[model samples]
Structure formats: structure tokens, C-alpha cells
Target chain A: EAGVTQFPSHSVIEKGQTVTLRCDPISGHDNLYWYRRVMGKEIKFLLHFVKESKQDESGMPNNRFLAERTGGTYSTLKVQPAELEDSGVYFCASSQDGRVYGYTFGSGTRLTVV
Target chain B: LAKTTQPISMDSYEGQEVNITCSHNNIATNDYITWYQQFPSQGPRFIIQGYKTKVTNEVASLFIPADRKSSTLSLPRVSLSDTAVYYCLVGGLGTGGFKTIFGAGTRLFVKA
Candidate 1:
């Protein structure tokens, strides 16, 4: 099976700009998750989706960040008015069942806000 | 989520058995211990998961004691390619009502 795929492995944007990251989950995966890691910090969860409905989004840092899973297959995270602090690697993951099985993670999109 | 503590880094050599341990003193009964390996510039890959006793797979073996507060990941005859950061995660990978966190993983440097 194909692993979770993330696009634009790296992105550089100016401050106050908008950046959108994309992820394509493995086929038949219903549970998709978003995680991020800033420099010198641990990988942290951003949100989770079960099909097209969000299951948990408590990890999102602020209102400027928005995530959507339109078809229950792929997901996108948009960071508006990006700040310098928003620079980090955004990761996407998918699972057969999050509670029971392990999740597969994408290579991650390295975002930089200048 | 239970907080985990592991060695910040370790050094091993080729053909040597390596054991990395993680301590989670406040682990709950329903929580499971999982290990993931992340190569440089890549995402984390699940190594193994176990609740109690021992679980072995083609890649590595996970040993959990009766207490479940601590777990060990054992790799046999590791090669240089085995060098990577190993993260020990504690808690249920539940669909709801769960906080996902990653502790400072153990960086294993396998020498030739």
C-alpha cells in the first residue's frame, strides 16, 4: 500500500502571507491526522479527522490555522497571516484505526516564514 | 497522556545488540507503549507496540514488564543503517479524547 504523501516538501513564505499544505492519505484510511514540529521541539499533534468529519482538533495552536478534509481521503492545512513562529515541519498521518493500530506518517512539509 | 523519559542519545556498533528503555511512571492501565523510528529528513515509522510482556517482529522486539510503566525496545545485530531517532510514545492512539505527544526520542548512533 502507498504511504501517506505530502506535497511541496519545503515552502518558504513571507510573514503575513498565507500558506496551504496538502496531504494524501493511504487508500481506505479513514483516520487522518496532522502534526507539526518546530525547530528544537517535539512533534505535536494538530488535529485528527475520521472521514470528512473532524474528530479532534485540540492540538491546533490558534485561530489562524485551519484544516479541512473534504473527501475524507486527503487533507489540507492552511495557515493564514503566517508568522515567523509558524515556521516548522508539518506532518500528515493516517491509520486504519487510530486507537487500535499504528499510523503512517508522511515525509512532512518544511515551512519557513521569512 | 503519560510523559516518557528516555536517554537523549546512545552509541552502538555494528553487529551489536542495542536496548533502549523508556520510563513512564504514571502510565495508566489502558495505555499502550509504542516505538517509532524516524530517519533523517523522513517521517516517523512505527516499530512496535505492546501492552505487556513481550512482542517481537521482524524489525525489533518490545519488552514490557508487569508494571507497564516502563518498556524496552531491543534491536539485534544492528547495522549502521539502523542509526536513527527512536521515539517512545505512551497512551492510547484513540480516535477521540486523547492528547498526542512525543517525548525527546533516543538518538542511536550505530558505528561501523
Candidate 2:
């Protein structure tokens, strides 16, 4: 089976600009998640999606960031007026169920905001 | 979600067994201990997970003591390819979903 696919493996944008990272999870997976890791920091949860509905978005950093899973197939994370601190690797993951099973993560998108 | 603490780094030789331990003193009753391995420029891959006692898979083994305060990930005959950052996560499914908490993790470097 094909693993999770992320678009624009690497992106560099100017500060105050907008950028969107896309993730196409494995087929038939019901749970999708977004995470980010800034330089020298551990990976941190951003949000989670169970189908088209958001399950948890408590980890979102601020109002400038938005995530969407319109058809419950693929997801996108958008950062508006990006800041230098937004530069990091963003990862997308999926799981068969939100239970005890392991999650599969994508290669991640390295975002660099100059 | 509980927090996990592990070594910053470790070194081992090829064909040797490597064990990385993680401590979660505040682990809850329903929480499960999971480990993930991540190579540079790549996302993390699942290695093994266990609630208590021991669990072994093709890639690695997870040993969780009865007290559940800590766990160890054991890799047998580690090769240079096994060199990566290993993360220990402690959490369970919440009403919304599983919000996994990742620690700094243990960086294992296997040499020839």
C-alpha cells in the first residue's frame, strides 16, 4: 500500500505571506492528524480529524493557522501571515482507528519562512 | 496526557542489542506506552507499544513494568540503519481523539 503522501516536500515563504501544506492520507483510514516540530523542539500535536469532522483542535498554536478535511479524504493546513517562528517540519499521520493501533506518518513538509 | 522523559542520546555498535528506557512517572491507568523511530528528514515510524509486562514485534520489543512508571525499548542486533531518534509517547484515546504527547526522545547511533 502507498504510504501517506505530502505535497510540496519543502517550502520557503516570506514572512507575513500565506502558505498551505497538503496531506493525502492512506486510503480508507478514518483518523488523520497534524503535527509540527520547530528547531530544537519535540514534535507537537496540532489537530486531529475523524472523517470530515474535527475531533480535537486544542493544540493549534493560534488563530492564524487553519486546517481542513473537506471530504474526509485529504487535509490541509494553512498559515496566514506566517512568521519566522512558523519555520519547521510539519507532519501528517493516519490510523485505521483511534484506538490501540499504530499511526503511520508521512515524510513531512519542511517549511521555512524567511 | 502524561509526559515522557528519555535519554538525549546513546551509542551502540552494530550486531549488538540496544535498550532505550523512558520514564513516565505520571502515567495514568488507561494510558499506553508507545515508541516511534524517526530518521533525519523523515517522519517517525512506529516501533513497538505495550501497556505492561512485555510486547515484542519484528522490529523491536517494549517492556513495561507492573508499576507502569517506566518502559524500555529493546532492539536486537541493531544495524547502522537503526540509527535514529526514538520517541516515547504516553497517552490514550480521549473523548475527542488521541492527542499523543511526544518527548525529546533518545537518539541512538549505531556504529560499525
- Predicted candidate 1 versus true structure: per-residue lDDT over B1-112, tens digit per residue: 6999999999999999999999999998888888999998899999999999999999999999998889999999999999999999887755663666789899999999
Candidate 2 at residue B18, lDDT?
A: 97
Tens-place lDDT per residue, model 2, A81-113, is 899999999999998887534589999999999
**lDDT (Cα, tens digit) per residue for candidate 2, span B16-82:** 9999999999999999888999999899998888889999999999999899999999999999999
Candidate 2: TM-score of chain A is: 0.97
lDDT of 2 at B56: 95
Poorest 10 consecutive residues by lDDT, candidate 2 chain A: A94-103
iRMS (Å) per candidate:
2.0, 2.1
Give the whole-model CA lDDT for all candidates, comma-separated: 0.91, 0.92
Give the runs in model 1 whose Cα sits over 4 Å from its true position: B93-97
Q: What is the lDDT of candidate 2?
A: 0.92
